[model samples]
Target: MLAGKRILLIIGGGIAAYKSLDLIRRLRERGAAVTPVLTRAGAEFVTPLSVSALAGEKVFTDLFDLTDEAEMGHIQLSRSADLVVVAPATADLMAKMAHGHANDLASTLLMATDTQVLIAPAMNVRMWEHPATRRNLAQLLADGIRVVGPNAGDMACGEYGPGRLSEPLEIVAAIETALGQGSLTGKRILVTSGPTHEPIDPVRYIANRSSGAQGTAIAHALAALGAHVIFVTGPADVPPPQGVQVVRIETAQQMLQAVEAALPADAAVFAAAVADWRVASSSGSKIKKDAGRLPVLEFAENPDILATVSQRKADRPGLVVGFAAETDDVIANATAKRARKGCDWIVANDVSPATGIMGGTENAVHLITAHGREDWPRMSKQDVAARLATRIAQALG
Candidate 1:
């Protein structure tokens, strides 16, 4: 999707600066031409030679080099790219950008550029949450700059919170979203993600190995393409993407109700691993542990959310996509599921312990449509989601 696009990557100083190298390679792999500019502090972490080598272009550093300025003026340099990306945007750099300071080449380009700018911030938890930093962030947002992540996780300082830079593939996905042709701009999409927890008692419950990473990524990708997304999510470790309406649920029945409420959308993606069954009669309180006897529990089938939505006679979505997570005969089972559920498409992935696709960062899926199964290569969940979102957009059109 980024073929022939010009990307101006501004490297900021931080421990996560290394990830920018991978980001450059990934963008180049997708046929984007990269121009790298390094801040003075950024040079402390990564060498100009390394940046130049990875980008296959000269690294711009000095703001007052007469020869370089004669060749390409700073104003032209700033305006040449389709997009400006600042990775590891430190607190200092952010403040400078927010206040329009042009003390350095990086800040000057950021101030002078007219193109859309995307920033990925990396800092300590305290620094990220500081009132000054928060104000700067708000200013950037008000100025229409797109911010990707300062994901909550362990930082280089050995502390954990919202200060980690997003992974390389995630940054790539955001860039693609910013540059996509808006194929799904006018569509309305519904997606369900995560694993439903069936309560056995107030304290204990039944759940699965679904992290909802893939499904949540799908919703974000759809929204990035300008689609109005109604995201019905079960309990997940990760936070939901911004700019999309989210509905929270904890059980199969709740998910079904949420999906029903979001009907008449252009497409539906049943990616949540809804429980197969629930406790027939859940205890109001925690069950007491007996000295020698095991408690007897009864199971009852949960509602078939995907099948119900796909087979709806009134106010049905134009297209329905279901996910089949299987241990054996993945494609065959998914094919049967597509036929039985009457969904327009089925995405099948093997979740056996041996495969490790479940709750993992990557996936290999088969897209089962009326024509045949199209096997995709093993890739990051974000890539898988973006590709699937694009396909849904095309199908909707």
Candidate 2:
């Protein structure tokens, strides 16, 4: 997708810096010409020699190299690339860019360049949530810079809660989305993701294996196509796309409320794996276990979010899409789901243990519409997302 693209890769200092080498190789494999610019601290984590070797290009380190300056002016060097990418963008670098500080080659090139800047932030959980970092991130977004990852996982700091850089493949997907032509421009999209946690008590909840990858990717894909996205997600492993308005929820009831509030959208994709049942009367306090007997729990059906939206009298989206995760008769179930939900389309995938679709990277789905079922070959969730986004754009148009 990035064939012939000129990519300026700026590696930042962080434990995630090693991942940048793989990023460089992947970019090159995709026909992207990479120019590595290593920050001093970044060099501490990953050697310049490895970066150069993987990128198949010379690494630029010094901010003021007389020889480099004579060959290619700083201004020219900064503007030479079609896109500027900062992988493992540390807190320090983000702050510098936010404040327009140019003490180093990376920051200087950032300030001097007119090309689009895309960053994949990597930091400790605390640093990521700090108010100052939040402010800096907000400012960067306002400045129209693109950001990816900072996914939630066990951090190098031995703590958890968001701050991990996206995987190399995920970063590549983000870059592709950023560079792709805007196909959904002027469209408004609503997407729901993740597995709703049905609370049984303050500390206990029932959830699913949904990581929200497919839905999140769809939201990013739609946003990349120029759609203003409203992403309603439950607890997810990945951060919401940078440019979208994310409405976070916990329980299925909460998700329904959030989705309803985000009505009047051009299209709505109900990709969330909302729990079918929730505790009928959740205990206010934790239920103590008794050695003699097991605790009894009552359950109630959760709201049918897709059906409600699809059958809305007013402000119903032009197109409503639902998802069916089935172990058998995937197409039939999906077709029936589309009819039952009154949604315009349904994406059905087999999540049987044998298929390994749930919580996995690739997905094989059937797109069931009013017209007919279109079976798609197994592909990465990113590919499905891109194609779905394009299809939504065309349908809206």
Candidate 3:
């Protein structure tokens, strides 16, 4: 996705500097040319030799070196890349960037750069939450500098919270979006996929024929357009897409919880084939069939995730989309569902046995909205996802 792109990577002082090694390799693997600028504090964590070897380019460290200055001036070097990225953006580094400080080679380049800037912050939990750091962050964001993550997890300081660097692949996804200048950049999208499994016993569960292909395609499409996708998915036949924050779940209730937790999104697409009912009293152990008699089971309605979110008075997404996988009366059923669920739109498709769409790749869908309905031609799931993504960008543009 980053083919032919130039990324000027500034490594800052922090434990996360080690991840920059993998970041360099990932960017190169995608055909991007990386130029490394290592800070003095960064050198304490990772050797310049290792960074240069991975980047396959010279590592710029000193701003006053006569040879380096003569070869490429600081201003030219800073503006040479398509984007400038600071990995392990420590508190000190962020402060300097916020205040336009140019003490070292890294900060100097950041201050001189005319290209787009993206930062991945990594610090102790306490440092990240400090009021001063928070102020600096607000300033950087106000200046339109893109920020990726300091995901919450166990930190090197033996503390846990939002201070870990995002994974390399996640950053790569963000890079793709930034380079694409996608319309949905900075938008947070929530997507649900796969068939939820409702447990009946320790060894048995009920599920549908959903493969999660469509939902995975949707998440990938949104991410490609620079949207941050929170992919809440059930166990499926296929793996979730890369470049997304994935929340794995098994039942309708769990999916609902995950979705609610990822709220305040700009938009949400509920595509999972969630079962309507679950075993009212699931057996802790396997149900024994010693006799020839069949066992009776009680069922209870599962939580209505779509309606719940659509009707939410707080943290409701600006645009809510629901899906109707119908066997009959495709458009009518879906249209009614759109009104019943109070969602802005409904993507309805026939999943009847005759249609072969339950687990199939292609889909012929009808889009139902307050304005009207649009019957779309049958197309590959990927194509459908692309179309939907474009429509979403238009709606939220």
Candidate 4:
């Protein structure tokens, strides 16, 4: 996927700088040409000779190297690559990138670059969790810089949280995503995930068993395909995917409002297991137990987000996909549901306890459309998401 790509790699100072060498090898193996820029602190960890040898390209170090500037101006070098990648992006580096500080050659190139930037942060757990880091992360995201990972695990700093740089292959995957020329590039996609909570009291609420694994995977797949995804998610078992516009909501009504707010997209996928009903008269406080006293709860139908969006009179999405989690008559029920909901397609799955699909890692589903129904073999949720994303790409194309 990364063939013939030009990547300008900036190695930041950290214990994780060693991994950047391996990253260069991985990128080269996939036919990507990497230009190395080693920071002064990064040089303390990895030698310029090593980086140059692995990258098969001259290493750029000094900001004012007369020979380098004569051969290729800093501005030219920065604008030459398709993408810029910062590996072992330490706290100092992230803050600089976030705040636009260009004191050194690497930071200067980062500031001058017109291309997309991807950073793999590596720092102490406490530094990673600090308020300043959080603020910088938010700023970077807002500035359209893609972040790979600071995966949670034991750190070299003897602190454990989220400060480990992603593995070489994981960084490669992120690079591929950044440089992909997929069909969904520049497309806007809306995706809803997880189960909604309908509150009955201050502490009590009703919800489904949706783990949101499938929806999260779908959002990741869409983003990997280069779609600008608007992810509307509810309280979920797993964390949401990176590199997407995430909108968190708690209830079906909130989900609906969020979905509507993210309108005029090329596609919308309603993967959330929204409740069918909510308490008509929810209690403000906890109900006390008393002898011969009973509390009756009335039910009201929740807003059908899928149906409403699909049947919109204006600014409807080009493609609207809904999910049907049925235990019996799966295909038949889903086929009817697709028509009833007025969606372009319905992905139906057997969520019975025997299948272990609901809240499970794998899924077996039927794709229902106006054309017909196609039964898909059981596969990991990630596989399903990739397939669905590809299908969406094809449909949009």
On TM-score, the leading prediction is: 1
lDDT digits (tens) for residues 19-39 of candidate 1 = 889999989998999999998
RMSD of each: 4.7, 7.7, 12.8, 7.8
- Clashing residue pairs in all predictions, respectively, total 0, 0, 0, 0
Q: What are the TM-scores, per candidate, against the unseen true structure?
A: 0.75, 0.61, 0.56, 0.59
Candidate 3 — which pairs collide? none
Report the CA-based lDDT of candidate 1 relative to the real structure: 0.91
Compared with the true structure, what per-residue lDDT tens digits does model 4 show for residues 111-171?
A: 9999999999999999999999999999999999989887878977688888999877668
Off by over 4 Å in 4: 185-210, 220-397
For each candidate, what is the lDDT? Answer: 0.91, 0.90, 0.91, 0.91
Instruction: Kindly provide the TM-score of model 1 when superposed on the true structure, using C-alpha atoms.
Output: 0.75
Clashes in model 4: which pairs? none
TM-score of model 4 relative to the true fold?
Answer: 0.59
**What digit string (tens of lDDT, one per residue) describes model 2 on residues 1-397?**
6889999999999899999998998899889999999999999999999999898889999978998888656778789998899998999999999999999899999999999999999999999999999999999999999988688889877899999988887787678777765767777889999999998899999999998999998998898789999999999877888899999999999998999888889999999999999999999999998999999999999999999999998899999999999999888888888888899999999999998889987898899898998887686787689767867876887
